[model samples]
Target: MTKTGTRNRINAGAWLISPPAFFAVALLAVPLAAVVLISFWTQTGIRDFDTALTTANYREALSDPLYLQLMMRSVWVSAAVTLVTVVLAFPIAYYVSFHVSPRRKPLWIFLITIPFWTSYLIRVFLWKVILGYSGVLNTGLQWLGIIDDPLTVILYNVNAVVITLAHAYAPFAILPIFVALEKIDRPLLEAARDLGEGVVQTFRRVTLPLAMPGVIAASLIVFIPTVGDYITPRLVGGPGGLMIANMIQTQFLRLNNAPMGAALAVQAMGIVAVLALVFVLVLRKLTRRLAQ
Candidate 1:
């Protein structure tokens, strides 16, 4: 094609993308930029703010040990949720992709996503009831002669958060992994077997390596949102389950410290970006080493 024709094509492509790009910038970029600016401002009292630019909010948010602790807790809770979801999801994805009949694969995938049909708030509340003292689990266990008494420790804890988050995010984990597993070349498995490799060896050498991209994708999808989640932590997490998001919520909603809250949010975003980068880099290194 002539340079003029090529230039027109490029312009046409840019024109096609401009609408959504502008829309995204107007909605997303504007709000994020506002938050970044607010994080630098100073708050005098409840719902009162000064236009004076200062780093007081960031300074306090960083130096204050309480917010730091909450941020760390958020990281750990998100990590645990990601780990559990991916681990539990892998088996179901593997089964559906490799064992279930191709004709029925869609049915199984639909079944896995049934939980998403309900409201997320409803899911958290359902877990609250199920795990509450004298809840279904304890009552059923007691009826079955499994335990002597109702376990008070069943709800309002980190374990409960992990279980609920894992369940809520399971479908996200499963879909990516199932897609990856589906794309694996069957002949590779046959080749490994022909070389006399054991089941575990074949998986380690071929299956897992090939499926890792999906696993990493699933982890990032689950982990990033899970870290900023305030609802699950609030409903089922109780005081002990409060994450950085909860603290951020408190600063803005309860304490009327929007600047501080914005600072916390900014810090959380930075931490998430750094953590995601690290995960991708480490995964890439490990996969490279495995290939060697």
Candidate 2:
């Protein structure tokens, strides 16, 4: 094509995307910028903020013992949730991709998404009920004569938080892995088999490598949001299960310190960003090694 034609095509493509691009900038970038900007400000009084730039909020957010503990706890819980969700999701996704009939694949996917039919709060609340002292699990265990007392250990704790978040994010992890698995060439498995590789070896060498992209995507999707999750931890987490997001919420609402909250939020985001980048890089390197 001529240079003018190429330019026109580029201009047309730009025009087509301009509206959504502007929308993204307005809704996403603008709010993010505002948060980062507010993180540097100081709170002077109740419902009062000083526009002067300072790092006191960041300093306290990073240095304070409580905040540091909360940050560490959030990371730990998020990691556990990511690990559980992906491990559980992969088998389901793999089964659907490799075992289920193509015609029934859509139905399986639909079933996987059935959790989305309910409100997220409702789901968390339901888990709270199931894990409660006298809840379904304890009652069932008691009826079966397995336990004498309703277990108090499962509800309103870090274990409860991990369980709830893992279940909540399971579908997010499944679909990406399903898509990635679907894209794998069946002949590669056959070729591996023909080359004297066992089923497990074929999978370890061929299937998992190609599916790493989706696994990586699912991990990030689950990890990023779970790290910042407030509702699940608030409803089911109790005191011990509360995460950095809970602290941030307290700063913003209960303590009336938006600047501190914003600083904490920024730091949480930075930690998640670093972890995600490292995860992707490490996974990619491992994937390459597995492929070879």
Candidate 3:
């Protein structure tokens, strides 16, 4: 209430907030600003500096068929991963939330999260070993007389990319859906049963509607990162499996075309952001209608 006390309180509040604010600017904003700035200028070499601002990079990236195709492929692959993860996770989440005893739920959840405790790169490489020409799958299939020859289709392709990304992000999809399902009141289902609703009808009317937000959240979490992912595609994707991020990498690292690479990065982020916004908006509208 006193002037000195009020001043001290204000200072303390600022101090409390300042660290995070400083961290955000230092870690996020500054790097992002640098990328944007670099995107506008053409690069000649690793050490060469040219500060001339141009739209040539953006124009070339937008107009190039190869880049455009890669971008489309990226979108398609990420969308597929999101869809598959959500569909698979929903049933698991449903079973865990409704059917399992509370005492054992944490154990099941921990098992679900166990894969995440392992190194991601190691897990991915393990898939490579399993899916390779002389890998366990091929060897087993051959021994079982299921296949006469090694299958090259499993290692480096869009299918491999989808499989890897889906596995990697599956936990992300599950947790949100599980949380949403757990938050639902049990009495709602009981009330539905009391009103003579069938099991499928109750789920359709009560459970699915309430779980839309989690579905949206999970889809965004999986899709957005998958779209921007370079590692999975690099490790699993063959020449034909190259996505937009791969192209961006080549532009920056191999081609030494920083401006073009930056343009591609910016474009990828922008497109994903717009799609995410649209998804969130649609989900919000649907949630409102469901509430009504």
Candidate 4:
């Protein structure tokens, strides 16, 4: 090509890529950079920003039992939600992907996604009513003489948080698994069957291994959001339901300690990132072995 033509092509390629690059830098990278910078600084309760840099926020967060406890609780709760959602979603996804007719697959997938069209807060509030002492479940149970008094144990606890999150994120878990399961060739299952493998053995050896990527993807999606979630715990978790996100909110808004809040936010993000990395690495290794 001529020099001018080559130059024109180069400019066109740069123009095509520049907008997204600029948007990412402006929207994502810059904000993340600011948060990292602020995380290293110090802030008094009265001011929003402090120019002084210190390790006090990180130290305080690490040393404080309440913060540490909340962090651990967040991890555990998120893990539980991810596990439940994955376990429940996998079978539904598998059925829709492999067992159902192609004509019916879209319908089943559509039904799976119907819950997401509603407001998340409203859905959670509905659960609150169902689980509440004077709510439908309690009323029904009392009428049937299933129990004498109302059951307060159903709401305002870690279990409530887990249940709500699991329901909310189930679709997220299902879709990825469906995609992975759908990608598997039918002949592979036939090959296993032809090799004298039983239904359970074929599934264990062929299907589950093929679906690991989706499992990892779904788990990360549910787990990451659950860790950073403030709403589910705030509304459902009365006292023991508080997570690290709650503390981060308090520091940022109530105490006006932006720097400290940023620090805590970074700490939480770092922990999640590390865990996600480990999960992805282990999943990739397993996938490689399965492929072999």
Q: Estimate each model's TM-score.
A: 0.97, 0.98, 0.92, 0.92
Residue-by-residue lDDT tens digits, candidate 2, 96-148: 99999999999999999999999999999999999988899999999999999
Off by over 4 Å in 3: 1-14, 285-292
> Which candidate number maximizes TM-score?
2
lDDT of 2 at 104: 98
Q: Flag clash pairs in model 2.
A: none
- Candidate 3, 1-292: lDDT as tens digits: 9999999999999999999999999999998888888888988778685899988888988899999999999999999999999999999999999989999999999999999899989888888888889989999999999999999788799988888888999999999999999999999999999999898878877888899878998999999999988888999888877799998889888988887888899889899999999989987787766655
Evaluate model 4: give its lDDT.
0.90
Stronger candidate by TM-score (1 vs 4): 1
Overall lDDT per candidate, in order of appearance: 0.92, 0.95, 0.90, 0.90
Q: Please list all clashing residue pairs in model 4, or write none if there are none.
A: none
Q: Write the per-residue lDDT of candidate 1 for residues 1-292, one digit (tens) a residue.
A: 9999999999999999999999999999999999999998878877678979999888888899988888888999999999999999999999999999999998998899899899999999999999988799998999999998888675888888989999999999999999999999999999999999899988887888899999999999999999999999899888888899998888888888898899999999999999999998998787766655
Candidate 4, residue 172: lDDT:
99
Model 4, span 223-259: residue lDDT tens: 9999999998999888888899998999888988888
